[model samples]
Target: PPARGPLGGWRKVPRYNALCTLYHESAQQLKHLQLQLAAKEATVRELRGSLARQQQQQQVGVGEAGAEPARSLVESLLEQLGQARERLRDSERLSALRVEALSQEVQKLNQQLEEKNAEIEKMINQPPYEKEREILRLQKSLAEREKAQATSDVLCRSLTDETHQLQRKLASTAEMCQHLAKCLEEKQRKEKGNSDDQIATERSNQVFLQLLCFVHVLLAPEAFDSRDTSSRFRVHTGNQNHMHIQTKVEHLRGNSPGQPGARRTASQSEQTSPPADNGNSGSEGRAQGELRCPHCMRFFSDELSDEFLKHVTECCQ
Candidate 1:
């Protein structure tokens, strides 16, 4: 039995050993698979890290390739900014010049406006007058003054003509007086020695003196009074006529060298004395404005006496 028990146990042991061998092989394969999986995971991590590094290297190469164009674009943008700044500075300078020109023009206009204002003020400040009327008044006054001057000149010319006529009359009267004086001197020379001649010379001298006084009174009315001439002439005219007639008779008779001169002396003495009654009658006749010619007994007016005397003197001459 014991030997038989040993043979059964050895059979059980072979079965059990077979089971254990199968379990061991399964565990070993699982462990090997796990180890293989862990190893693959590790390999996968390394490969991903290596791929990331390769992608970073590829991106660095691309950035290096694009760098030149980006730098050129930045340089062009900087140049455009510089050009824009220069254009802005030029525009500011032009604006300043235009402002200065406009300021000067405004100042000139202001000065002209001030001058016009002053002229307007002057016109407003004065008093008013009529320009046409004032001019007419002044012209009228000038015309009146000119007319007065012309009239005065005409009056002066007329007065000058009258003065020339008066001077010519005075010259003629002076020539007549000279001729009468020469005639008297000749007569005195012719009758130098006889007493009767002496008496005649004295009477002629008296008549010459009276005629000179009468001529002077006629020429210069301012020298003597004229009122007494007519009355005095009337008183003496009769005697003068009688003496003249006697002188003419003596001249016609012709006195001889032996004859006495007594008749002539008596006649001269009688002529020298006048009666008072004759003077009274002459005064009455003058008062009545009756002038008579002693030779012809003709009645005449005092106004006609000057013309009558001129006729008598021409007849005697």
Candidate 2:
């Protein structure tokens, strides 16, 4: 076979096409990754808000439970006060009955005194019975009158003491009730404030999440155009498919005149192509395998050990 010119590399189209296909597929994968990253960021934002809300709800539950003791105490106190009120009412009723009974007793005593006096007068006016019998009856009636008077004094003192005690008890109960009512009002106010704060906090968190979601949705995915074009560049050379493309180019450049720039560009393009002429395998050749990770500058390790190969395969995958 004769030496071919530089432009005679179309025979290597299969290999060049393979490389172009690989680059396009890798680019599409990168685009997919960018989209996934955006989606993940949005999800992370929502998770953060959900975490905050869950914490707040947990705290609220704890606070409500904590408040129960004080509320229960208040309710118990109110119950006791109710019982006390019932007792006081009963006491007042009993006192009123005692006072009425005392009045009736006094009236009966007055009537008894009058009757005794009338009986004595009748005995004097008639003067028809034995004097000894009349004197005995008068003596017994006087003793009974003295006992009735003492009983009336005792009843009056007892009633007066009970009335004073009831007044003091009523005043103390009223004060206690007022204190409890005030405490309850204050507790309710504090709870209201806390609830308002929690609600505001939740609303703010919701707004934040909404903003994050909106940004994620509205922001453009990474532009494929911005990526490096080196991968897309298909450099045909003489070695690939043994097409002898460079030979053809050289023959053309030599036979044709006034095409030095095309010859030089073709030459440079061949020099820069991957898999430089070397005995080493294309992948093992550092000149061809020298890929700089766009994200990091670390050189890929040479080791084909299980771990290294696994990591590289996984990263590419």
Candidate 3:
């Protein structure tokens, strides 16, 4: 037999040897019985031939006195032959029983041999213990990997939820920032409009003060009297003062031409101008052509002395 492992085939060798020895011993016993039966058959045949010879001799010497002894011998031979036949029958029976038992023993040994062969084949195909242990180790590693995968899946889900929440917060913050920016822009625009209105009002007030000074200088004749030394000095400088007033009027007109204050001042100047004097109508007409309100760009007659002052007051407000 071929060996599958060091001990696998060696362990069965003793039993195989014992079975083979038993079979050989049984064959030898059967052969011995057969030889004994052949010997007994030959002996019985020899005894029958010898008895026939004795009977022939007795027949030939029928009247002799030795016939009695011969008859006694023949009787003894027949008895011996019957005993031999009985012994042969007994031997045959014993041999048949022995052969039957041997056959049954051989059959049982054959069945046992077949069973041993099947066991040997099974052992040959089976894996070794080391391979079985390796398979167990691999299965354990696979289980650990599956556990790690499950944990990773859970972590991924949590991270995904966090990312979604952060995105929503960012979107809300952006919207709030946009709203704040729009409110700040509207406030700045309103502040700028108020500042512009304040600056225009200041300019209008300064123009009104300048117009008042010009009107006072033009209408107040006592300030230009030549009797006093200070009045004579003022009369010498009146032309210069007139030029300065004209420059101021042109400046104010250019600076704020289309203001609502200017429109109100024009209407007031129209209402305040006095009627022309019949005696001095020609001189008054020439003077009116020369005098004008800077705020409304309207000429006035000299008889309307306080009209410019009243128009400036109304227009500046």
Candidate No. with top lDDT: 3
The candidates, ranked best first by TM-score, are 3, 1, 2
Model 2: residues with Cα > 4 Å off, grouped in runs: 1-129, 193-317
Error of 2 at 163 (Å): 1.3
Better of 1 and 3 by TM-score: 3
> How many steric overlaps does candidate 1 have?
0
Overall local distance difference test of candidate 2: 0.44
Per-residue accuracy of model 3 over 231-259 as CA lDDT, tens digit each: 31122124543454344433334323335
lDDT of 1: 0.50
lDDT of 3: 0.52
RMSD of each: 52.4, 64.3, 40.6
Instruction: Name the 10 consecutive residues with the lowest summed lDDT in model 2.
Output: 216-225
Say which candidate scores most in TM-score: 3
lDDT of 1 by residue, 126-175 (tens): 34565567778999999999999999999788757755654465455455
- Candidate no. 1 TM-score: 0.25
- TM-scores for all predictions: 0.25, 0.21, 0.29
